[model samples]
Target: MKKDYNFGYTKVNSKQKTKLVQNVFSSVAPSYDIMNDLMSLGMHRLWKKRFVEIMDIKENDIILDVGSGSGDIAREILKENLLTNLYLLDLNKEMLFEGKNRLKKEKNIKYFIGNAEKLNFKNNFFDKYTISFCLRNVTEYLLSIKEAYRVLKPGGKYCCLEFSTPKSSLISSTYKIYKSKILPFLGEVIAKDKNAYKYLSESIDLFPSQEELRKNLLDCGFTNVETINLFNGIVAIHTGYKL
Candidate 1:
């Protein structure tokens, strides 16, 4: 039997795990953007800005921003006038809808309500693939990685922005305090859902570290796997080339 994962470090199997994640995001969709600001102290926006700014996108590049919640990354890239063949994909329909609503004015942007593990796209389809702040929720990380690679054109770039463990013990301790106590409190007060925030904080600890993540990308046949850390490794941008 194939293994599936739950956010609480429990084993459930991939299919069930996917359903669980969809439920989670659906529950939090309404307050997703606000919670991001509260949890990251609005640094999430800056982080995305920096992430996209570094991509150096070219004209006519077919880019897919998977797990694109509320279209923040897509909006930033489009606003910069970087590319036109931008596709926004997400597992949670509600989250995708949110992105759609925000990006509707940009009529050229494409949208897909789909799974990351089994991408609903053709092979060698995208020039650049990006998954931001959503991998930790994916039911199968390796499959998602492979799907990103499979959909990319030769020499295409793959980028991921995700939570990671801090390198410094001091910073880790401080972050632990904030995630464990402060985040849940804010979630309860603002989103009226303490458990949702609690799951998110715990999920961070379950996520792979920088080195492990690099190896995973490498194992999926990605080359030049590199990571750029931010906020003392609370999050990182992992980039690789499909060669």
Candidate 2:
């Protein structure tokens, strides 16, 4: 029996979901950054900045950034600590190519086309692991979380920045309207791919909440689990340590 997972609002088996997600990213790869600005009104940039700040990157720390779309978070981390060794991994080759193109000038940065649930790196290799706005789309998010735990060295930290449930009723209602109605419209006009953006909106709603994610981190042996809500919990940064 094949286990089912979400491909947007539609349910499919794990392999289909992975292929569907890859197609979605491939279709939107060219316009991803543009649509991000349009979708979040440039708030994603600030969110990533704050996400990196919370990481408190140190000089020469080895970092693995999973689902490292377009290298936005990688760029932010490098800006803070240029000496940090960075690995950017993504399932979609097009997305990885975009990231590689953007960070072409940076040193100590390597990009790989890979899956988050099954990272290629050896156990306890990375000092810090990060996945931004990417886990929701994974075929098995729990497996990805476990992989994050597996790859981080003892005493290393894991940070995940993602769209999460909102704290306020009014904002939540408005955000829902924007996501369901406005986002796909912008995707069509800007990215010329409405379905891809539709998946983005649907995926966010289906993703685990901050507390739920904190519990997952705890379950995976991540201690000192903490969540920092940004924009009133519309987006959140979850951090934990492998002790």
Candidate 3:
């Protein structure tokens, strides 16, 4: 007997998929941030900045930054002095360590190794839940959303920044060329993991569109769900309130 897992647009057996994803990240973790800038031409920074700007962060906010690779999102939030407790959770221990090392001086931060589909947190505990550039990579992304809702306090905000399909024909066509041709090339050259970067590029088109994702959030017990597309839908910031 075997169970299937999604690795980008393709499905594989559960163990196989998990191993592949782990290997991919472990191979790229050291060069991950660099490749991001090269691959996206630095647009990812703007997308992240916009996502953080929209978060309704208040004083003493307890935030769970799920899939917080290298702690960039967590650091951005902490820089604003908006959080009293900031938890950085990632499935991969290597990524968690990278975050811990980067944010070593931060006293209010904690790192945890946890799965998104099954987060180890108390219900109604988090004031904000942020998952950036990571939702689609989860084997059970929908379940992850439900788990996010479970942990968020009433009126808590759930926000995500994820790659999405472009709505415009011109931008979409241009993007296709870049991801298919340039992304993997840059990956091989920079990260020495061509396949890993290939998988990342492939996952973008496999992601749910903005409206469909909004509906998923609504179905998962979220309210006031909305999305703001960036760069004509190359990415989007989806947010909802748990009420």
Candidate 4:
């Protein structure tokens, strides 16, 4: 049977989609964090902080951060001393390598090379699962959400922070120009990977709307799904519980 795949705006063959995404992340891995800060004016940190605050992490909780590029979200969780175990998982080795180097001496963090759509962990293994700016890049968002649901314990929280379209026409238009023009240019100069940044912008524009994503989380077995718009709807944090 010929497998069907969905990549952003178009449908593609399933067998090749993973490789395509892998290539994109690999190309941008070296300067992903730097470019993120540049593109978002360091608001990514504030957005991640909101995610952590809303989760209200507890001590001795095992937290899993999927698509954890450079361990930014994990580091934020660790800083609060609310987590007993922090697992940073990503498909791109380069991204994990950068994270590992940044936290070589940290005892609580463990890096794992794994796909979000096919987590290797046993059921009910994590107290919380969080992803930042990554859900949009996944080839199968619902599958990844299902994986998160499988790994999280009952009553555990699942939070995702991702880019979304702004509601205001004026703001949306201005932001679109910046993303399509300024972001890629800065990414090329800093990351030296123009194509990767181009893909990032394109992916954000092509991703599902906030309401659609909330429904996706519900479809994947999440309960009480809610979305909180940040930065004037330019980004949103979606939270749900496994009941």
lDDT of 3 by residue, 1-243 (tens): 776666866789867776788788788888888887887788888888889889878999999999998988987887676547898999888888888989998898888888898988999999999999989888778899999999999999999999987889999999998988888899989998888988988888778899899999999999999999999999999999999
- The most accurate candidate by TM-score is 2
Q: What order do candidates take by TM-score, descending?
A: 2, 1, 3, 4
Model 1 alpha-carbon miss at residue 28, Å: 1.0
lDDT of each: 0.88, 0.93, 0.88, 0.86
Candidate 2 residue-wise lDDT, 1-243, digit = tens? 777798888999888899999999999999999888988889999999999999988888999999998999998997785589999999999999999999999889988888999988999999999999999988989999999999999999999999999999999999999999999999999999999989999999999999899999999999999999999999999999998
Whichever of 2 and 3 has more lDDT, that candidate is 2
Give a tens-digit lDDT track for model 4, residues 14-110.
6577787788888888888888788888988999888889877998999999999888887788778654788999998988898898888889788
RMSD to native, candidate 2: 0.8
Per-residue lDDT tens digits for candidate 1, residues 49-110, read 98997676888888999999899999889868754688999988899999998878886788
Give lDDT: candidate 4, residue 239.
94
lDDT of 1: 0.88
Candidate 2 TM-score, C-alpha based: 0.98
Candidate No. with top lDDT:
2
In angstroms, give how far residue 53 of model 3 lies from its true place. 1.2
Which of 2 and 3 is ahead in TM-score?
2
What is residue 75's positional error in candidate 2, in angstroms? 0.8
Which regions in candidate 1 have their CA more than 4 angstroms from the true location?
A: 1-4
User: Which 10 consecutive positions of candidate 1 have the poorest summed lDDT?
Assistant: 1-10
Model 4 spans with C-alpha error above 4 angstroms = 1-11
